[model samples]
Target: MAKELEGKVAVVTGAASGIGLASTGALLAAGARVVLVDRDDAALAAICSERGDAAIPLVIDLLDPKACATLAPRVLEMAGQIDILHANAGSYVGGDLVDADTAAIDRMLNLNVNVVMKNVHDVLPHMIGRQTGDIIVTSSLAAHFPTPWEPVYASSKWAINCFVQTVRRQVFKHGIRVGSVSPGPVISALLADWPEEKLREAKESGSLIEASEVAEVMMFMLTRQRGMTIRDVVMMPTNFDL
Candidate 1:
């Protein structure tokens, strides 16, 4: 039998690593052609070389306003149309608010929150015209709780949670499904800056989930029946407490 996503085209931002990379693999396995967007040209080239034509790499610095604004158009130029958008590009900022660099905080918020909104905004017109699409943002469990250690990071996710829900309501009539997958402490580079002790503790406690597991949830969301929308999937390792 043909796969559920056969003939679909998906665009995944931050596709060089972590959840984005894993999601690209899942999309390809489901028979969709995926466009891998990332700032790391070498990584994108390496992935594209292995994946062949099924994985198209678009080197993009999403921090550039011009680049973000023209993202949808660029994808359409490359793939002809977009059936799915995994707006998964982001950065992490942790530690107490006062201890964070002013510039670092700005960059984190821009990537985690602003860029997500712009990508969705840029793609909405096409999806609206087609009246069908799946847009999933990679959110965090931090959004749902006020984690004291990462105030800045958590705040960005909280903003995303609101954006996803509000946009879903507005676009459901147009047959566009907007949702977020909020996972807790996935094993990815986002945790690179975590205090060594905290990271070690979480690992020992089995509180860290693999990126592929989150991708599985994303696949489930994309494959759901048209009439239904898996609005928000909050997944965490069983041992994860918050």
Candidate 2:
């Protein structure tokens, strides 16, 4: 395998499991040293034990401004120079906007949107100073169209689309690629609480996608060439029949 990403440092938010874990493992396999950040320290430790020193587990409350501020410098401390950032941290609030509690909406916006925006703000200067970086965000299929059941999630993804695209235009000359990957519903630990039996039925009847598929697409988008500066890649399973 080509160590194209060797000697590079990657900071992946929400790296405990799901698509984040898959992406982390893929980057490691491709030879990049990784730092895993998540709220679940126990799980992150288990993952590090499995992957060893190639991975660093950082369990901090990302919602805290001080904590988030400390992230870039910590990443730099660990790897000297940062090359890739996967802004894949997000949460789901599956309720219609009208009746959804105000606090819940705020939580959704804070975790899914505000935190990511701040992560970009905190870490981007390092990339700009170095004159290189790849910023990858995990948005949802809800961004392109709409999902009535998850209005807040859809809104957050739309925000990400705007944020990343605007940054892409602003820093194109610096060679900083800002992009987002939108995936349809997938069977992930993130959705582990959902009725599996129901999901299986939906799968058989066509309703969601696989997590691995989404991760593969993310890797492709992150590693694309100069002429291939794709701003958005939307992937939905043929199973979206539901």
Candidate 3:
């Protein structure tokens, strides 16, 4: 309810739905001028309608490093400074290590790990110059648990978990707080869009974590004191076995 981000600028990927949409709402409510990015053009437009003029729409695949590089300055041109970046866009490919197709493996790795790192590397210089910003990477609980069947997706999450930890320590001196959220799953159009096989795999694993719950936690993390940041927060349903 506190407008901690008043007059600030925040960029969020995966903004069309799921945790990204929910978090976008929270950031807007907190009075942050938000830039919403997602590959889905129609959906992005729809989401922007909900946030109205305060939200800028970016329709680009985050997996493209070239696009990621252009994002910071374009965003700065709008709001003049960047205060928050929630890298929530990602994909899931289900398969065993030996059985996974090389193409699918590459897709998962590229989008999950490489795209995220590209965004961080590209936007960081500006954030560092400003000497104050927050970066939130969306990871998953599978990063910490046994999810051998989803080798590439799980591996990417684990890599991000490690990435956030190290970056938090390295960037604190620059007044940039880097952290990650590990969520179990979120029932969004994402599930409906997934390949039937992959959806079946994910649903068998567990129900999706609600978008609002994840959004609230992300908002809470970003609202901490100027010099403080939460390193990690993992979310799951109460009855989730893990």
Candidate 4:
């Protein structure tokens, strides 16, 4: 039986762990060859090895604007063409904005906001030429509402929410579909510092989801029929509050 994404080529950033890793696995299972991009070379190599030939590992620090510019072309040169660009690379700093470390804030914005824009800018032209592509961003529920404890993180997602909508409009005529999956709390490294008590409460309350669950939603967004576009999917645990 042929898979839905058979013969497709995808580039997934932040692919070494968590949702990114899970999404890559989903894409591969659907028969797409994937270029897995991450900052950790060793981990990326290990996973790519485990996944075999379908996964191509690229170690990159998304914070470098120049790298973003060159990434798509590099992937194209290697993979021939890219059918999907999963801009899933992002960071989070959880704390009151005033009390947050300025350095952490800068890092989060640089990766979560700036890198996403740069990657999109670089990949859009190729998709335009092909006149078909799918760009899925990993956003967060915080984009929809204020997150007092992580103002900067929320603001970054809010920015990308607008970006996805605006870019979807810009390239829709050319057969490019742009959208985001905004998940609430998920079991990932992003929550590693979430005050143990809070994490415990969320988990115990069934308010946290697994990374693989979000990965499946990403697949749904990608596998939609050509005429259909899934703009945004906000996935939160059923018992989640707010």
What would the per-residue lDDT of candidate 1 be over residues 1-242, giving only the tens digit for each residue? 14789999999999999999999999999999999999999999999999989999999999999877878998999999999999999999999888999999999999998999999999999999999999999999998999889999999999999999999999999999999999999999999989999999999999999999999999999999998999999999989965
Better of 1 and 2 by TM-score: 1
**Distance (Å) between predicted and true CA of 18, model 4?**
0.4
Q: How far off is residue 39 in model 2, in Å?
A: 1.3
Q: Which candidate is the best by TM-score?
A: 1
lDDT of 4: 0.91
What digit string (tens of lDDT, one per residue) describes model 4 on residues 191-234? 98688899999989999989999999999889989979999999
TM-score for candidate 1, please give it: 0.98
Residue ranges of candidate 1 with Cα displaced over 4 Å: none
Off by over 4 Å in 2: 192-201
Model 1 scores a C-alpha lDDT of 0.94
Model 3 C-alpha lDDT per residue in residues 1-242, reported as the tens digit of each score: 88888988899988888888898999999999899988899998887886789998888877677776787777878778888999988888765668768897788788888888888887889988988889999898878986866777888888988888888888899999998888876787545535687667666766557889899999989999888778899888765645
Residues 82-188, model 2: lDDT tens digits: 78899888777665568768897788799888899898888888888988888899988888887776777789888888888898898778888888888888767
Clashes of each: 0, 0, 1, 0
Better of 3 and 4 by TM-score: 4
User: After best superposition, candidate 1 residue 173: deviation in angstroms?
Assistant: 0.4
Question: Which segments of model 3 are wrong by more than 4 Å?
Answer: 189-207
Candidate order by lDDT, decreasing, is: 1, 4, 3, 2
